[model samples]
Target: MGPPAPGDADDGTGQRTGAVIVVAGVALFATALLAGAALAPDVGAAGDDASGTLVGSHGGGAGLHERGSVYLLDGREIAWRAGDTDSYFDVTKLDNGSVMAGFMQSGYDECGPYESPCAHTGFRIIDPNPDSGADPEITHEYSFPVRSEKNSEVHDVELLDSGEFLVTDMDRERIFTVRGDEITWQWNASQRYDAPEDPTRTDWLHINDVDVIGEDRYLVSVRNAHQLVVVARGEGVVEVINEGDPESTRGDPTLLRQQHNPQWLGNDSVLVADSHNDRIVELERGADGEWTVAWEIYAAEGVNFNWPRDADRLANGNTLITDSLNKRVVEVNRSGETVWSYNTPEVPYEAERLPEGETVGGTSYADGGGDTTTIGEGRDVPVLSFLLVIVQTAVQTPFWFTEVHVAVTLVSLVAVLVGLGSIIRARVRARR
Candidate 1:
């Protein structure tokens, strides 16, 4: 054509221009990632600010499992860890300096009816010798078998003065007590909810937590149903919070979406870790006998709560929280200000502070809270979402680098690539 275009081949001018465009695009994208993370609010100082020993249960599933353990932190340092199983959840330190931990492990010889190398889930008594700094001895274990380790784990266990152990069983969807080797008592959830033909085949009702709120009364957390039920020893179904039809998925999930540990404050109040909702809610029972949110905290340390799995109302009027995806345990005041915090290397299910222990009837939320909504609420970009899944399979990413950040970086990079392609195509056409 008439004297070739400007960047056609000015002594490698087209190649130089193309290289600059590509390089600039990459630089911009990387810059966005860094800047986005920098803007996201980080944790408060480090974990050492708080005193006393804090015990947390490390659960598997998201990342490299099988390395799960029940770890104890004395002040800022990790004093001891016991992980003889694939995952551990719901730990309680007894008065005898021993910790009773509920656990799940794979490849068990005692698989009941299932084949060998199946999953075994139950509670183990671990003598926590923190000073030794080694995996302590597992004194005793009470476990049974299941097919796979998907949702068949024993999520909770509580010891009574009567030499009985209460447990929440996901395998059979029931709250049961085991004395020695005998199942002393059990309340099957099938009585209230729609039952599947085979409970082991599917995770029908994810009954995650149970607490001995009263003398013979139990507070149960039905996770998938998004409701809590109180069952007395003799009474089948005394009362149901968030009441809904048993045939369906149940009540208004917007109230408590797939929640985890629920701490019963008293007869009329409870504090829950609203997991999928990404918040901690303190619900008060109204005079009309209905539950409503009295106080809620959606975020702390600037970053929003991501899939928070556990929360406890402390005696000192503070709330201990387990932000799972964020991989940290935080203690916040009624105003939602973080008082103390501990960052874990991987995801932890729950944590309980020592001394006062898990006492009953916690204080109510005097004042409401700050930050009514969560930061980076939902995923904003499709490409970034897909890439994150691939990246996460290899390494765990930071929680604060949220969906909004990804959208901006991806859009900017795509625009640059489009411009680069147009310029390269023009240069090729000019060469002819």
Candidate 2:
């Protein structure tokens, strides 16, 4: 195949393909990396209405690739495994340098792969360099209690400065918080939204991601409701912002299109992962509850993005987005120029670009629940849907170049290659 575009390849300039291969070979030589060291066995077709799982090849030993790596912008690198996951979805860097991840826990009676079936839910916090040989920790195991044994999964986790966390339980239609191991606050859609008197007649609100902007302000995504909502944190949720006017005769709700993960960029503007339509929209509150779309990244035509799940508005005015199904992470500047990129061997959910220019990301897979034929450590013991949160730092340094840096690297490499070609050509001419 022809070389990928600058925006498409990990090192946009394509100068480091040989370097990457060489590094991979050297690492393999130094360490016999385990392939799928702790992956779930391949189950049959998933059940109906179950939370879908992303599947990958069962190769080597564990059936899928379980290795993860992180890189710094200066070529320094580190690698780690997500400690056997089915799928690694959302990823974030906390104040303490530990990474928080959200993903599904497999093995439910309801649905199979890709089906919206009932499934167990959980989140993990992976320490890049845990106490030496000690395995990484999966903090706070959770299940979306209530509503039969089906498609209950936590999509993302919002960390508060106060050391609390907000979790988005999709099938349960609620957002809840945990502080010091206690359920401190909660919001149920049936009570928070304007639901019909007969709950049976009410539509299910598929709440996806939650973001805490202030001590009392939160932004939530309701997919079916097709809107991003801002609510207060208290005994009862109070509406502080609604992006659209919901077409309800009761005039109690606001209508909006598919939006998720509203993150506050500043006090007035916020960035949204508009997944359904494949875009990133910046909304700023205007008069009253009305919001204006200030900026957006359209995933149409020649655009480099496809199905962006979550995005971070970086301090440098650039954006790092998880191109979910594409299994890649993209860094786009304010001018929409893709400055850097990273491709994954599996599916991706969320990604975080650290201040040091390293990226930590997550991945997931289907076909969980090991059988007798499947043998591996951490297998049979719930492989947690192959969700990996990766931190890619070293390999990404070449792409963070300013125009001058890129120019210098490109000129140096090309000059050396051309000089060698000239020498070989001269030797051939002399022999003739």
Candidate 3:
């Protein structure tokens, strides 16, 4: 039969080869389509522009495989960069053209993982300018070591007027002030939450952030507990927001779910990056002492907020968001309209505008400001989410790469595999 005339198989060899080519073409097209969507301009970012520079701290993944950076963006481009360390979480501008960032790195001696040698976690005073255009110089640092870097590193630091830095030590489950080499004052979470024999080994109450809302008063974000506590120095926790979010006491996890970077809007109001809940929320405390979601936005510009780490209420009545997993920093009007946005270099942790910073408040959606429409209350797409985690470890994803795109890309891939199998079968049959 002369190998069935060399052209014949289950189907025709030529037909099978054509099918493979078609499938490969479709796969490439689908991939390019997702890439295009990612690089597209964010919706509503046109005439609504923004001015001034930005400073950011990116919390990179564990180990050196994915390192973080402390960066300064000049308008739309990066002006300077530093800390190719393991991760950086919080960064704030200092009066002297420098920056103070809460950071975590690897390789240290003495204490648990880095002591405060226990060497990786601590605060650093960095000069954003290096005359040679190299990595920014770390002028000074207050380092702390932890057992490991996961949930134990320092997350947030505030430079207080008294020259002491307010530090959030997740390993110790405490908020304290460190000036020079001494801890001036401290507040431990064990006093309020159930104590653990060894906090360094467990992901206990992750007290991730603290800010001086007023003299002698602080607003703290207890991430795992899903609440914010107002602590008055020496007086202990004066008022607990979201205390006992249980059915018995107040346990309303709906109010907050592992939130981060809350901005104190007023005595009765605060804006939170409701992280796990995938939204930016503003809470208002009533006369009865219960906090209610005054205003919240689930999605902006057609993309749902994913693991957003920080949201700041700017003085101009705009909200600046560090949308972490989405890998962009977005600024929205009081009504949650995207006024401006910048794609971050990686999975960023926090961002602050120069000059005004987040030191004050602007417009509050609690009272007025429309556009409070909630996008679909999102749920975790585990497979897509897992794929994204792996992809992001290697490259910065576009803000528009959502689950829909992931599903499309996956389907195209399966089709390509099927086509390859058809080609293999045809080749084998022809040989037989």
TM-score, structure 2 vs. true: 0.56
What lDDT tens digits, residue by residue, belong to model 2 across residues 239-265?
A: 534534444412213223455555666
lDDT tens digits, residues 117-173, model 1? 888889999987667766699999999998778888888999987889999999999
> What is candidate 3's lDDT per residue for 1-432, written digit by digit as tens?
354653455658555675976677596757767676757655423333456545455644433225678887766767788856778888888778788888887767656433543446888888867466666889998986677777887888998889888999998899999889999999998777776899988997788999999898999998988988888899888888777644432346777888999998887788999987888898877777777777787777767888888988887778888888777788878666677787665688888877878774456666533223453466568788767655554555555666666677777777767777777777777667
After aligning candidate 2 to the native by TM-score, how far in Å is the CA of 184 from where it should be?
A: 2.2
- TM-scores for every candidate against the unseen true structure: 0.83, 0.56, 0.80
After TM-score superposition, the amount by which residue 28's alpha carbon in candidate 2 deviates from its true location, in angstroms, is: 41
Off by over 4 Å in 1: 1-29, 44-48, 59-64, 131-134, 245-249, 366-395, 405-432
Sort by lDDT, best first: 1, 3, 2
Q: Go through the candidates in order and give each one's C-alpha lDDT.
A: 0.78, 0.49, 0.76
lDDT (Cα) of model 2: 0.49
Better of 2 and 3 by TM-score: 3
**RMSD (Å) of each candidate, 1 decimal:** 4.9, 20.3, 5.0
